[model samples]
Target: MAFSSPELNFHKNIGFLAFLPLKTKTSISLISGKVVALEILYRMVYNSLTAFGGQHHERIRYEQSLADAKKAGLRKGLYLGISQAFVNISLYGAVALIFWYGPYLARIECWNYDAGVVMIIFTSCLFATNSISMFIPYIVAFIDAAVAGAKVFAVIDRKSPIDYTNHTNNQPHVVRGDIELRNVTFNYPARKEKKPVNYLLFSFYIIHLESL
Candidate 1:
């Protein structure tokens, strides 16, 4: 199957996440959406500053994030699928029992104890089988998350990019505030796009992007 088929509706599970139709206490329709977007922006900035929590590159980290999100969604879908599968299997198994055992039980000489025993066994099996199935995904997910979290932590634990400068040898030469960076070019990842070389002129820096 082509897993990457047509796009899926984002609101299937999270449909009720927004009550656009229902009368909202707030005036704005996108109030909740806007808040969420802003939160994400701040979180990204925080991650960039404090930790390597975010993927780093010329926006390649963004693709890593998208991959993680996609993988997570796939795993969640798989877990739910597993749960549903177990439920259906249990139902079908019980029906088969009904067809094969129910009639036979009815004809039993002393049916009370035998019928009770059968039900208990079936119920026990139902819960046990489904419980194991459910637990498997959680255990796997936990392990996967732990590994991912470790990698993320490792990134954050890295040495600081800039160390403190010793001003001893560095006599503060009066800067004319004239900054000149020659032959500066930023080659952004993957794409053919070229980024403008960053320049900061203290007093007045005349920047002519010959690159553009």
Candidate 2:
């Protein structure tokens, strides 16, 4: 679909020009009615290559921003690994303690050996099975999902400048006539603080021919 705004058209042109070779841009500049187009294209290329260096520079900056974040992630992973190791060691240690103490209590304290053994084993098994720390990954995933869902809801609840649903006040109707946009002042939203681009009246016109 064609854009009605000059800013949108300008951006679209820039994107299209980025993929073209230098030879193509030079050839297009030689064509008539392409002065404005070539000027915009040259500015886009200069800004992208020298000022920004396109995605290459942006990618490096993006990676640089994530350097600390990546280190933090590695640290978190290491901590979790250490925690898991401790949990495993504790589980094995509990089992060993049960085996070692059960016989001692039975022989010295005159306790029933089988009953002592059963109690230790059952208690250890219960504690190991019911521990919630084992589900750390699932809990982290749930928290992440909840945070993302809140962000999505915030965006969904926000009011937009153009509402497609409120069509009752401005109902669509057909007009049998030529439609024209004349003397329109246009400004790119990103560059709103800058001066608006003004075009003279009738400098640009759209001819809509109706059926006879």
Candidate 3:
């Protein structure tokens, strides 16, 4: 079957998307979206460092392709550093606020010191427990397996023009004899009207051998 250039390119890109740094991004997104809300921000900070290597590679490749490659690299690095700094500041700042305000509130309201401490500890533990749900290693593995299986099945399910495996009477059987080539026309599937040099030469040689 004939395929347009865009269709072929889309298929090629879709095939490679599964092999890209998707799992890492998914994990990081899960952690940041869920765990950050629970105040268990340290895990995300650690995970971010691990994920940065993949981003670094992507940034290097992308920046190097630009007209002002060095400037692009510098801009990317500065933006990343600033963003990471903000994240760190926000995480620690929230913790500091909790500790500082918790004591003040406890003293002013005549609440027990131990209760305030327990509240902070309990909140942290609650988020820590919830964060465990984000470690979906099995889910990622299953998704990868499913994608690979789909690709494999697509090829297997496709009907080839020439079925060598068919053993029925309707199928032609190969005999242990020399095959003859005559005035036959050959064209590639994509370009039916154009006779490529290699195909023309191959066809010519086959026809010449048959004549001899």
Candidate 4:
């Protein structure tokens, strides 16, 4: 019902990201976060193309993404328009059929039809059609909500690879251990060309005594 500024900002950002292509969103997220830092290094934080590396490539990628999004939107719009049109035609056609058939049925002697019965049927049909038409416009909104809900539940139901539970073999009343690491060589994926860290070694002994 109500959201704080930070939460509102996050939702707004997520909404923006939802409209963009996945690759474009990922690239923008990855690069935009460091834009300030890069700019700061060059003594400019705003409107500095030099600090934003790979400008030409990024521009091309973003333009492609934009075009893709626009095309997708247009396609979906066409589908929605067609669906709405069909629904309107069917609904109004049903109404029109009742309008034409009700009076005809009232004139038939064998069917025992009357003016009151015809009017009731016509009014009921009209009311039902109006109600459905009022609700038809919301179908698209409902579909969007369902899609978003599915994505949220997918993330919620996913299992994490990391285990948070701790299973220590030490006795309940006493704990003692020595941990050691040696010859660890690694480098960040972003800076792999720099150098791999080597000669890293460390050891620590933990000892503790307590009541159960």
Candidate 5:
């Protein structure tokens, strides 16, 4: 349930952090599913509030999520919500009916029951369940946030299979709109890259070679 600063970031291959724990859905489901969702949402809002934040980026994220949702239409979430509500209402209604009618039915010959006792016992559970309902959404929210955070964190945690090997030179390299790739093979990452492009925007120095 506790993640140190470095544990939050698994990008670097650290040594002796054996206590860091291996990646598992257990903790994420147990803790993050309840609390980390809120953390993710709040962090998202905070990030958006930062100076260079842009709504367009968030919108893009949302749209992509929608697209993915559409693609993975196997799951029915709205249906699940409706079903949950109905089940809760039905269960509560049945309990209420039992407590209400149990007294009348008890008066029947040899039908012995304590309606008051049942009501008191169930009432406590009802109240407790109701109280828990208040936190359920927050838990789900945290779960959602954790998923979002995890996606980003997972991306950040990725490693480049193709190292900057075959550098061809030891000095810093630069690209000034002019370079050549003939029979020379280069495999660009269409997706799966750990660091953000912005990080690379200014990292290089200069290159005598130019790209057409």
Candidate 6:
């Protein structure tokens, strides 16, 4: 099957990418089921390299990862603390300003509003300010969601270098021929000291039949 154009194929691919997360989740569950066996093999490898202390490299990497995790945690905590502090300050400052100005307005008769009206406005402002603080706890979650969304969209938006749907060139639909290799020999460069493997000759002929 072939698409009408590259853009149509691209759209079809974008539709396919929508199911990528589900595919990834299934793959992750399958991998998780094999984690125990994989861990056993990993431990065996680590044990085999104990004589040369190759395992120490892994230990160092683990320690470094732990340290990075701690640093990230600390940074997140700092951001949360600063944001909460700012929110609290803003909330209290608004309350203080309203209380101080409400009485001053009444005393000076600057506005025609009474005590009841003042209280209503004050309560509304208080509720609105408090609502902002409620979102502080979810700041980190929002950041993580934004980052994940960027990664997903990045993969979807990326362009492939080769357009396989383009068949303008003289490409054969069905190839029929004999494949022959004559005196082909090769060996790994690392094993140059050893004897080279030789392939003296080989041939594979195609057998085509006409429709009866």
Name the top lDDT candidate: 6
Error of 5 at 71 (Å): 12
Q: Model 6: clashing residue pairs?
A: none
Evaluated at residue 8, the lDDT of candidate 1 is 15
| Candidate 4 similarity to native, TM-score | 0.52
lDDT of 3 by residue, 1-212 (tens): 01122333343344334432443333334433342333223533665634555555544433433324344335434543543444344445545656666667678766565565748664774454334323322334554566457657999999887776877637546554444445556654324446553322223332345432
Error of 6 at 47 (Å): 4.2
* Cα lDDT tens digits for candidate 1, 89-204: 55456546654674477467454536666667556655554444344334434444554475479988997745447545545467554555555566433322445454433233
lDDT of 2 by residue, 61-129 (tens): 445544544554555455446545544555455556665676677777765566657586658564653
For model 5 the local lDDT of residue 170 reads 62
Which whole-number lDDT from 0 to 100 does residue 33 have in model 5? 32
lDDT of 4 by residue, 1-212 (tens): 01122333343344334433433433334444354344344543355655667566555644554564455566555554654565566657766777677778877763777788877876776666556555444555655555557657998999876544645533356545666679877875334444457766776656634332
TM-score of each: 0.31, 0.41, 0.29, 0.52, 0.33, 0.55
Candidate 6 ranges beyond 4 A from true positions: 1-41, 45-57, 166-212
lDDT of 5 by residue, 1-212 (tens): 01121221231122112212222232333432333344346756776433566546655554553443443232334433543464365446645765666566656633455666566656765665455334422333444455558668988989876556757636456647543333433332322333233322222225553332
lDDT of 3: 0.45
For residue 52, model 3's alpha carbon misses the true position, in angstroms, by 45
Lowest lDDT block of 10, candidate 1: 1-10
Residue pairs in candidate 3 whose N, alpha carbon or C atoms collide under 3 angstroms? none
How much does each candidate deviate from the true structure in C-alpha RMSD? 17.0, 19.1, 20.2, 12.1, 16.9, 15.1
Q: What is candidate 5's TM-score against the reference?
A: 0.33
Distance from true location, Cα of 172 in model 1, Å: 42
Ranking by TM-score: 6, 4, 2, 5, 1, 3
Q: Quick one: ranking by lDDT, best first?
A: 6, 4, 2, 3, 1, 5
